[model samples]
Each structure stands twice: as structure tokens, then as C-alpha cells.
Target: MNELIPKETPSLPSLPETVLPALDRLVSALGIPRTVLASSEEIEYAWRDLPRELREIPAELRGELIARMCVAVSTGLFDGAMNYIWNAAVLHLRNKIRTFGLPVVAQIRQSDFEEKHLLELQDSKLLELCLKLNIVDEDGFFFLDQCRDVRNNFSAAHPTLGKVNDREFTTFLNRCVRYALADSSSPRGVDISSFISAVKGPRFNHNQSGIWVQRLNETHDAQRQMLITMAHGIYCDPNTPEQARLNSIDICNGLTNSFTASIRSELINNHTELVAKGHQDKHAASLQFFERLGLLGLLNESEQHHIFSRAVERLWTVHNGMNNFYNEPAFAERLLEVSLQGAIPETVHEEYVQTVACCRVGNGYGISNAAVKYYDQMIQNFSPREIATLIRSATNNNNPLGRRVLSGGSYRFHFRQVLNLIDPASVPNAVNGSYIQLMR
Candidate 1:
């Protein structure tokens, strides 16, 4: 038979003979299960923090063992040898649980808790740590400032806690009802600001479905007729203030498809002339208006710009050659700059015009004139052949100006001529002497 050797698994270290009994006593008091208690190796790892014995193990091994000890302590398991360290770990985990969801703590109330409630609990991790360590009593409420406050209290007999005893258990539940209603912490609360106003009555006439009408006709309505008054203010028979117009837009943005189409159509019918008038930054404004009108997919970038540009042109014509009315050069330049921030392909003259006018990319040489002088300065230090290759590459990369220069063929001839002067031996094999001749 072939020789067989048994493989041994890594064994936990033995607890020190003198400390073993005391360690066992601590574990018993903490109510930690024997299986969950830190192993002897974990205890040795914790002891590595002692100065004299620190050098006995590799730093990586020390970190690994410490992490294992921490995991045990976080779950309330302590192996007596590292009681202080275990206490600190529990405190840290408690703090962590407050700002983050804790599997153990979250499981305590399954029915009442939600993802958002869990997130709120997670945010109070440090508070949880305080509760775990008994550093702060649950009844203590800490006022952060005028805007906010933190209340930590252990309520054992909360309505949600039915049947669960009012035992002297420590709990820190931050009572932030006002802030919670106002805060937009969760994705579901993206429109929290408006949502809060709606609940507070007449302030936000949120529901479009005659709910406001039904409330107004109530026999025993509130002390004041605010809802009816606000309704009258909104539909003042003829004139709605621009501020109200903007508020309606804000409300439309806040809503999630409830009467959105109706509201948008009403706004358009009332605001068509103003929108078509085209204000400053008409491209951006018009684009938003078109989106509201559900006409966004009907246009492309160039088409949108073209429409705005034409409208501006017409507005200018209507006011005569004054140019002060609309389509001002400065305005067009700003719109063009915004439209062409990154750049697509354009012709040579167009690119140069854009570059010089500060609309497109600028040459690194700081020369502004899109003429032969700048090109000459660019090739001053470089070989003509190298310049030709550089220009050729730029052209191939869709630089319209480069294509224009190369199309002339004179620049290439000049480049080859310059290469001849730099390396005479290579010039003899030249397919064409145009570049070399120009350099010479």
C-alpha cells in the first residue's frame, strides 16, 4: 500500500494555565456561548499589543488575529483574557450600528422597521455604541443646535413592542420626527420639501383631484378659510404674477405624473407668447420649454440650435439693423461656446475662426493669428519633415485647418526640404525633393 499521511488543521492555541479559570468565569458572566468565545490564538493576538512580546509575531499575523478577536467581541462574545479590548470593540460596533443597520438590532422589531427606518438606525451607530457601553442613559436627549436635536431613549413598552416586557434593557432611539419628515435622506424622499408642505395644509395645494374643493365645503372647517382664499389668489380672474407662474413650474417638477400633462398644457397655453419671445440663454430655456411640451424627441442638437438661432435672427430683423434687440454677436458667441465645449469636426477656416474667437481649442504656442506666421513659429525648432508628419497626423485626426494646409502641398515640400538639412544622408533617397528644396 502507498504511504498515507494525515493532514492536520491549524489548532487554536492553549490558554495560559494560570489565566484559564478566570477567562472561563468572564465568559460565563458575559453569557457568551463556549463555541462563540475567542479562541486561544485570538487571545495571544490581543496580547501582542504588549510592548515586550510585540516582536514575537509578524505584523500581518498580528492584524489578522486582532481582527478575529474584534469580530468575536463585536457580537458580545468575550474570552475573559481581553475584557477591556472586548468592551471597546462592542462600543465601536454599537456606534457602527447606529449609522448603519445592525443584523442583531434590526431583527428585534421586524414588523415596524423599514429600509428607511433601518437607515436611520444605521446613522446612529455611535449612539448605539453608547447604549451598548452604558455610557449614556436612554432618556438623555442631546440638543445639537436650533435646527436639530438628538433624543436617545430606551422605550421597552412602545406600541410596536407589544407583549415584549418593559425590562430594564438599554436602547437609544433618536427621536427626530420633525427632521425625519423634512430630510431627503432616502431616494423615495427626493421631493421631501414639497411633500412636507402638502401635509401642513393650504400651504401646498398638491392634490389636483377636487380634494381642496371638498375640504372647502366642509360644515365644520378650520378657523380660517385659507384654502379657498389661496384658490382665489391662484385664479385671480385675469392676472397671475410671474412668481406664481414659477411656483407652478416648481410644483410640476415636484409631482410624479399626477396631473403633470394637464398642468404642462395649461402652462404652455398661458405662456406660449413669452416662451416664443426667446429670452437670454434661449437655447437652454427653449430646450427646457420644449421638454415640458413633450417635443424634445422631435429635435436634434444642431436642429435645436438652428431653431433658436433663426428665432434670434428674426427678432433682430424685426428691430432693424440695431442688433441690440436679439442675436447680439456676444450672445451668439456665448451660445456657440456652450454648444461647442468639447468640439466635433469642422472646416479649416471655421476651426481657425472658432480658435481665434476663443470658441474652440487654442494652440499651446500662444499665437492667436490663424496665419502662416504662427505655423512658421511652430516649426521653428522642429525638422520640416517632422512638422509635415505632425500636421498630417492632425489632419487625419480631423483637424480641418491641418487638412487645409496639407491640401496646398507646399507645406509638405517645405517639410521635406527642411529634413534634408537636418540629415543629408537620408535626403539622397528622398522620393521627392520638394520639402528638402524648400528648407535649403
Candidate 2:
């Protein structure tokens, strides 16, 4: 248990020394026995004994609940203490449900229960629903229900047909503090931005990283998802430092399977949205994510193939008819990266070759620098037939536009590199000798 009480008590205005005297007068006026009044020392002890987790409760409730518990214990008003315990439990449960979001809360409502009817739930039913949602475990639910029974039987809110002893009341109060106030449904101390910063920072050593991974494992699903989503953003940002990106990837790989699944879904969704919006620069992030997935060996063969194929198709869509391929360099580089990672399937090799071969130069200045980088990768991966098809497509007479784009100016360097890869005899007769000489 965390320390709820400070080691030393300062003079508190809410718990004044005069409070007992006023209570004594009230008890006297009611003709109650004076034996019920307890000493100041006992009140202080009760306050000191409160659990640390309870200190994190909302300030309004924490102050009232602590004061009331202290007064009840000091005055031997066990029945009243039980009532306070019940109130604290109810407040914590309600707050937890609200934090869970309305979608989950709606699942708890009765079919006919309207939004205004939220507060109509009885305490017992609320505990039951929380238990159903796994918000509270079975033992917690049982213990809270038992506390409710005690409150109903002896607390001041009821007729007090029975009485509870100080020991029983204290036990109930401690249980409420543990099960309700300390529930995991509450927001964790760590937030998404801070989590991202920590992961991307170089300060966290191996032991610290292990500790964070354990925390992620224990974190609630909603909060874990938020952390992953933020981490993905950092990982995808092109401006993110290289070391930070690598660190982020390491952290993400350490996440639980559930977290990984959420990341996968989020990436797919982002890709779909970017495609729909026709945002070219944003698509680079998705391609980067795919390359990372390949490099990390996180993706299975089928998933890798699917992602690569979709990426190629998207590239095809973007560059299909446009003369200037704004993303051609990035597209070609990502293809080579993915291919080098061994993620691209042999089945897609033909399509991959054709896509690069058919891609048009945006302008004289916008040569396919990525395609130049991709030359060695293509040589290593492409079959002879595929290589021949690529050369023919770039140099064939029927496709004068393709021939002009490949054989002209700076593009000749890439064309010569391609020629060097295949049999010299396989080269088309129409190839310019000047460009071929430049290859030497």
C-alpha cells in the first residue's frame, strides 16, 4: 500500500481540535451516551492509518471521506463510518465508469434506460455491472456488496436496527480503499506524450526498458492503445531523428501482442485514409512503417506480401498517368528497401519490375534517383525474363515516350546501368552509343 498519510501531520483547518467538543454538545443534546466520544489521539491515529492509494482520490471526496472517517472512528460512530465507506466506494466506481468512456458505459445500461437514467442504478446493480465488465474482480464485487449490507443494516442512512463494532468498520473502510480507490480503471500516471518521449530518449537503459514493458503489459487496454498510437506517429514522422526512430521501433516491438495488433490496425487505417485523401507525402510514412515491419521480422510472409502488393498498387495509382512523378524517388527507394529486406515475394517480382520500368520522369530535373539506387537490387532479385522485359519496355520502338525518358540526358546513366546488368547482345540496336559510352 502507498503511504496515504504524511509522516508528520500539520495543523489541519478541516480537522480542528474544537470539532470533538462541538460533536460532544450535539450528542448531549440528542441524549446520546458520552461514552461514544473518543479522544483526539485516537482520531489522529485513524487519519494516519488511511491507505496511500486513497490519497489519490478526487480532492473533494478525499477530504470529506477522510474527515468523516476520522470523526466516526474517534467518536465510536461505527455505523456512520460504514456509511462513509459505502459513499467512497460508490463515488470511485462511478468515476471509473465515466473514465471508461460512454461506449462502454452504454453497454452497462438497461435496454430501456435513457441517458438521463444513468444515475437511476442502485449501488448493488452498479457493482454487478462493474464486475461484469471486469472493472472489478469477483472477490472485490463480493466484498463491496458485503460492505453495502453492513451500511444498509447499521449505518445512519438506515434505521440502524443493528450495530457494527469499530474493528468491523475499520476492516470495511480498508477494503473500500483498496478495491475501489486503487482500481486500475483510473488513468495511469504516465501519459502518451511522456511515454513516447521516454521510449525515444537515450536515457532509458535495459533494466528501465524492461520495467516499462512490464508496465505496458499491466496497463489497461484503452491507455495502452493510446500509447501505441502516439508511438506510431513518432516512428512515422520523417523529421524524427534516426536514433529516436530506432529506439521507438525497439519499444514498439516489445509491446504485447494485443498492442501490436492495435498498431497494425491503426497503420492500415491510416494508409487507407491517406490514399483516399490523395496525400502523397503522407504515404511515405506508411511505406516506412512497412519497411520497418520487414526489417524487424514482425510481419509474416502473407502479411508482408499483402502490404508490399498494396503499396505497389498505390504507387501505380499515383504515377499511372502523371508525367511528373513527385513520389517516384521515394517509391523506388522503398521498393528497394523492402526488397532488400526480403519481404517482396517472388510472385510480385514481375509486377515490381514493370512498375519501375513504366514509371515516367516528372521533368528533366526530376530524374528517378531512387530507380538508380534500385538497379543493383533489381539485378539481384529479377529473373532473366523479367530483366529482359524491363529493358525492352524502356528501349522498345513502339513506346517512343518510354525510350525518350530512359535514353535522354541524366536518365542515360540509369539506362547504361541497366544495360551493364544484362547480356550486351540483348541491348536494342536503337540505343545511343554516346549514352552507352557514359556507362564506362
Candidate 3:
């Protein structure tokens, strides 16, 4: 079992008083006019300033004018405002926001290219102003430390994808959006811009816009990682990550029938009765069994997280299913004639039978009587002793996997025999019963 521990916290940074004003000036000087109508003290005093000429204005009118002022600044309406007035107002607001202890500049263009696109200029004059101010650098815009990488650095690039390698899932999202527009013969660029604007509101500054995009990209990258991990876990090994396991559940379910066949071929060889009667309908019966076993909650969670935590539980299910094949009296004597080496553990037959009966074999999609019979015959005909020795060696170990493999192998051997016999009518009833119930 693994133990978790808490990490030590790091020291907090000492915030400087001048940082806010400097950041505010940096952004505002880049052609975005800052309008500071009132100082923090003035605004606080405005509440008491009510009853004066400013108070004579209706509250609704005052609100409208303030909103209008914001819109005008955002849309670059008061372009003729004196440079000194704009700079002074910006400085005041910077100090006001800083006094409250918030980051002055959340985002900023780090490179020349980023700055050019981050804040789309409304006119050539705005671009000229930005250039004159030297706001745009040589590369992209630099954001605050809150930003995280969204791209997949580990995955190899798709051969046909050109330069799309390492990009985050948002890159795919963008592609999908473009595809959808093209398919519908719709106006794309404008519609996409509008959609983005609706999602993140109109971009007040390039810095804010960059931050928003980066945040979204980070989220998509996380989801993509989960998906990739889940797919690998279910198909390759049970010990995979929880997120990956959960993602692979549907794939596992789809492959259940084939897995069921493999289980049957490995478990109840040469049993015609077991074949005829069939094992319980796995999907329905196994689900009900788990519910009765007080394991339904875990089962559901496994369905959600890919059941890696219940490695023991899954082994039990497999064991139980295999034990059903062994109880068949027809197969009991037939084992003597077959090569029993690798087929089943001669020394611990009783324990093997018990363990197999307890394993949880889910919906019949994974175990088949025909397959079990074939394995039984193969073990008898070619390597029964090897199979038996395998069982014995597995049993001697402390690894829970030892028990799991012994149980699964025993079933596989019998399953091979059952299939070889191919006479469903002669199948064993003992092999059809769950060993779990028998033990109980």
C-alpha cells in the first residue's frame, strides 16, 4: 500500500508598492487610454459628497455616465484627450487598484508578434501609437506566472498534421470549429470571433485575452491526458492510471465477448454439459451477484475510474467462474488421462477449486465453455504437466497475482478441453455452477 504525504508550503513573496503603478503605466501607455474620474479617497468621499452638485444628478444618470465612460475608453473614443491627463488618470487608478492588493498587470505582451495580434488595433493610428511606445517586443506577449502549458510535449506528431505537433486540445477544438463552419457553408472568421467574444467578453486588453486563451488551453490538455491514459490502461494492463482506466471502460466492455471466449477456452475443457447449459449470463448475473455481494458500489466506481483499486475483487470474480468448470464429475476423471502438468495443480486442487469459485468474472462476454474445453484437451494432449506445474509454482508465491494467474490458468486449461470435446449436450452441470455458491 502507498502512503500520501502533505508538501511544505513555500514563503510568500513580498509585494512592492511601486509594482502596480509601473504595470498600469506599461499597459496604458500602449495606446489604451485609462480614465480615472475619481481617486480612491474621492470615491469613498463621494458617498458623503452626495447632496452636492454631483449628487443633484439622478443615480440612474450617474450610472449611465460612468458606464459610458468605460465604454468610451475601451473603444478608444476619447483619442484627443491630452497625454498628461490620460497618464495621470492611469497612474491614479493603478495606485487605487494596488491599494486593494490585487495584481496590477495580469497579462502583457512579451514579444513583438504577440503584442501586434493581442490587442487588435482599431486603426493604423493605434498601431503607430503602440510602435512609438515600444510596447510590442521581439517575440510573443509575456503573461503572469499563473499561466500553464497546454501543449502535449510527449506525444509524437501525426505525420499528416504538418506543424500541428505538441499543440493542446484547443488546437483540435479550433480545427473542429473551422470544419463545422466549412461544412455548413457559413461565414467563419466573423462568427468564430463573435463566439469567442461571447465566451470571454470583449477583450479589454491584449494581456487579459492572452490569459483567457492560455487558461482554456491548460484545461483541454488535462482532459486529453486523461483520455490517453485511460485507453492505454484498459487494453494493455490492469495496473494503469485511474483516469486512463476509466476512459478505457467502454473499450473493455466492447471487447468483453472475446475475453469471455478466452476465459472459457482456458477453464472447463471437455465438459459437454457445461457447454450445453452455458455459464450464467455474465452481464446480468454478474451485475446482480456484485449487488448481492455488497460490491455494487465499488463496481460502479470501477466503471467510473477503471476499477484498478479492486484488483483483488476482479481476481475473485475470475476465480469463481473457473471453479464452476472443475466441479463437473465428467472432467474429474478425464484429468487423469490428460497431461496434468500445466493443466491444473494436482497438489492444491482443493484450494485451486476454492479460489476459482470466488473470482468475479463479469458479464459472460469474457468467459466461454467451448474455449475452456479446448484448453483442457490441449493441456491433456500436449502439456498438461506443464500447466499443473505452473499452478503449483503460482500457488507457492505471496503475490496475489499468483492466485489470480493460477485461477485463470486452471480455467483456461479446462475451457480448452470443453471446446475440444465440442459436444454441448454432454457438458457438466458442475462446471456451470458458481464455485462461490458451492463454497458458501
The best candidate in terms of TM-score: 2
The number of the candidate with the highest lDDT is: 2
**1-440 in candidate 2: lDDT tens per residue?**
87776433333334566777877788789999866654445555555554443454445456587678655766667677777767877877876666654443453342443335447778898898677555677899988888888788878888977665545666778778677865435532243445666867775567777777666665565456666666666766677776776666666667734555656666667666766787665556655665665542454465567657866776666565464345566666666666666634666665676665545332345555555455456554655556555655565546633555456774555455555666655444545353255346
- List candidate 2 stretches off by more than 4 Å: 1-48, 51-56, 63-66, 95-116, 130-168, 182-300, 309-367, 370-440
Whole-model lDDT values for every prediction: 0.34, 0.61, 0.30
Q: Per-residue alpha-carbon lDDT of model 3 for 1-440, expressed as tens digits?
A: 87864323222233345544544575577865443322223222322222232222223233443344333222222221112122222232233223322221121122333333324533233323223222222121111000111112211211221121212222322221222111211110112222233333332344544443333232222222332233322323434443433333433233333333333332223122233455333233333322222233323333312222132234344434555444332332233222232233234333333233222121233443433443344333433333333334334445442444345555444333333433433324433232222222
Question: All candidates' TM-scores?
Answer: 0.26, 0.42, 0.17
Question: How many clashing residue pairs are found in candidate 1?
Answer: 19
Q: What's the candidate order when arranged by decreasing TM-score?
A: 2, 1, 3
lDDT (Cα, tens digit) per residue for candidate 1, span 128-211: 433432233354213212111111121111122111110111011011211121121211101222322343334344463234
